[model samples]
Target: MAIPGYDSGNVAEFALERAGARAEVVAGVVPDEFGLERSGRDPTATALADAVEFVGLEELRAVDAFRIELVYDPSALPPGASPTDVGIAVETDDGWERLESTVDLEATTVSATLGGRPSGSTIVAIYDGTGES
Candidate 1:
């Protein structure tokens, strides 16, 4: 399913592999204040694009597996940050957890797979800098 990014002109894609799983997915760009506040929680990382929230993800907890892909603007990245430095971070009960993702620089997309569901908000974050957090 393709979730519109509202005015951001970006589209968040979701795919469920379970045979009988359904969810109402809603997504949008995270507000600047919120993104800025949360994006810098890791000292070595900085947000390169607007964070995106995937609403109604609680239903996905029952699924066996799922994948989420987020679109980000390369132009929004800070100086010295390359596409290879991009990765996906998901909000969880513990904190923001960075997930292993496959990035397509040409497509400006980052994808990650989850075995179950996140405990907190589901947000797509692009962090740049040192070690993964």
Candidate 2:
């Protein structure tokens, strides 16, 4: 099966693998920004575009529930910015809801559990206290 409008090279391949399906690129590519690059100098180099569109991955839709995990490096954040300063919001039929979060600074990840979400709810994560978005 061929999927249209996805990255042509590694991104599509990776999405296919993650989807656990065999799919070919039928049209348009997923673009380089969607793929990871190890340029020798930066072995951990990865660029996740601000947004990505995935098609034909019904398996992903099977997720009954999910947790939002925001990972950040303390050193990368502005001085004096605490991990608790961040928060996540999920779009509901009525409006946005703030999720109760757990902060794990050692792991540099903040997690918030969101029960089952609507099919196409937008999740917005922001620096709630004081910092950049």
Q: If scored against the real structure, what TM-score would every candidate get?
A: 0.57, 0.39
Top candidate, metric TM-score? 1
Best by lDDT, which number?
A: 1
Off by over 4 Å in 1: 1-45, 131-133
Model 1 Cα lDDT, one tens digit per residue, 1-133: 3323333233233333221112222234322222112222332245454455544554332344445566666787777776776777766767667787767777777766655454455555476555442
Residue-pair clashes per candidate = 0, 6
What lDDT score is found at residue 45 in candidate 2? 19
